[model samples]
Target chain A: MDDARLAELYERYGFLVHRRCLQLVRRPEDAEDALQETFLRVKRYGPPRDGGATLAWLYTVAARCCFDLMEKRGREPVAEESQLAALEERGDGSTEDADRRALLGAALRTLDGKTRTIGVLHYLDGYTQDEVAAQTGFSRKTVGKKLKTFEDRIRQLFAGRSHEARR
Target chain B: MTAPLPPSPRGPECPPAAVLEALSAGEPTPDATRAHVQACAACGAQLEALTTGRDAFLRARPADRFLRQLERREAAAPSPWRRLFPVLAAVVPVLVLVLVLGPRLTGDGPGVTWKGEAFRVVVSRAGAEAVPLAQDSAVKEGDRLRFAYESPEAGHLLVLELDGRGGATVFHPFEGTASAPLAAGQRDFLPGSVELDDAPGTEWLFAVFSPRPLQAAPLLARLREQAGRAEPTLTCDGCRVSSLRLRKAP
Candidate 1:
């Protein structure tokens, strides 16, 4: 597509771009950055006329940007044993931010390192699970199992967090 | 053609998040998802939760306003796109923000006053003319001095700016109200308001907008052309204006 047509597509897809990024990036401004970067790529390499793969392709670019942005911030949200330990020591927000973070953290910590990475890069990043599997080199079956597990853990974690926050 | 959002499904007896997502995507939903959303409590809560988020995020966002400005910008912007025109694209949105946020945020150009000997000129878009309401005119007890207009589309201003100085020079960029129509061949009596500190001769200008050291412009050309030099005046004899010997370039 031409730049104008690409821009039209970009605008139409902005909300999804933003929401998907928000779950992983933890900040609205960062999500906006990811979105801009996504469009900048689309601008550089004209997107497909197929349109079906357009969102998937955009998601891949955004996924990479998220990793880069995370790396830039030196907050690679990996599930190393040490990292999981650090998560347990969590900060003092104790409010919704802390509570949400803790639930997300516990759920994230439970996944195998690769699985967790895929889950965050997909659901949290707004990538389809298939795209996540493709980017991370996981089988689609593995990615699906990881996401379902991730979801269950998160539900329990958030439920627990909500209970704690309530008290 | 884009299809309407599917009827909502239920989970948790509330609307579903998926429904909003589908709607946001401007896509059609499957019958199962729609039925599930309408009856499912969990899905219903998800919908409410997501809708609330959408409302908060999109609501807090000046998106609607920005979208309108972008529309106007696209309309007015020239085809040869350049990265350097960020400032130009921003003009409409900035104008919309100021108006939506109220006058204090806008700094100046809300109300400007010029005292003509025969009448007082207050330049604000209140009446029809797409022109400033003239202070000196056949004022009647109910005659309003001016009116404002906001172009329906965003790019009008860009095109306005490019359409050349005359038309572009006379815009109340933020004024988005309806325009008052002047009669057929009815000469425009008063152009709008005059600035006290403009250089000694009149310079035809569009409404000048700025925050610091706000000033007004003479509506002479606009006035003369509006009504064919029909000495714009006050409707009442008892009324008084600040000054009448307005500095004329002529």
Candidate 2:
């Protein structure tokens, strides 16, 4: 993309990308770095061709950048307590939502990249399964299957954490 | 049988965050999504949060600064051909020499006299248009200042301030231990602004541009020693330094 178009893109969507990075990394400095890296990737590969899904596309890119930064620092993804609390508050006040929200970062670490991306799109961003499928270019069945796997992994993680806490 | 996925915490009628973001950006969205976002309190709050967060981000790290950082990062990486051709590596120094010396030889560029490094300070008072500060201009305690720099090469930059009461502080990167990366050949304003404190004295703003990252700790240490000097100078080998003096009044 040319400079003007790129500037316009940054002006319009940079906040969403920065917010996504902040959610994943939970550090202002690291989020800024990830935000820069996301735009650099955009400058290299160009924005997604699908105009409608641009924010979703940027979110995925920012998430990948945040994950890369976390890996580079040799640290596991750790959700801030405030973020987890916000997640719980936003959800229906159920134990399942609480468990899922509390263990989300750990559960996401345990899953593969594609599944984690799918999970974030559906659970975190509140995209419907159909919307997730459209954004990811996957069939609805595959999106459902991946989301199911993600949910199972979260449960497994919660069980393991509970077992450890009980011990 | 595969278990059904959990329903979204956001209601079924609520649009995705992406859709909300797009709507916030004034992009075209379906009427149904717009109506739903307007009617749903949760969705409305989400949209408002997005807007507030965006406004904060723009105020802190404006688009120009973000773009400059992007350009610097892109310029810092070597191209595939540069890696593949060892012979081409020899040509780079010659190219640098031409870029550094060519402007002086022709006297064609506006910054030819400054040796390709320029530092400018723009000051904004309450409800007034910002104007670039002339050398040793008078400023007030409540005045806000933004910095801009131009360089002949891509490098790391540190903007430091030496206040009248013998205090030295890093002005750019606001709170970092190292110099921020700067793009070459553009006179771009740095991210964020600095508001003058209630210190009444002559303050010196220094822009240190170097090809390699410089640690702020050592630089500040040296500046601290020289803070009381009538004219402070720092020794940074192979780095260009530009200084702006301001008389800060109470």
Candidate 1: misplaced stretches above 4 Å? A1-7, A48-57, A76-167, B1-20, B41-45, B48-250
lDDT of 2 by residue, A62-167 (tens): 8778778877877645555565555423322243455445455456666898899888877667688888899889999999898778878767766666677799
Score candidate 2 by DockQ: 0.21
Off by over 4 Å in 2: A50-52, A82-106, A130-144, A155-167, B1-8, B75-250
Would you estimate the TM-scores of all the predictions? Answer: 0.34, 0.49
DockQ class, candidate 1: incorrect
Q: What TM-score does structure 1 among the candidates reach?
A: 0.34
* Cα lDDT of model 1 by residue, B25-142, tens digit: 5556677767776676555555565456555655555444434544554566466556547866888788776545543343223343223222223333345443233422222222
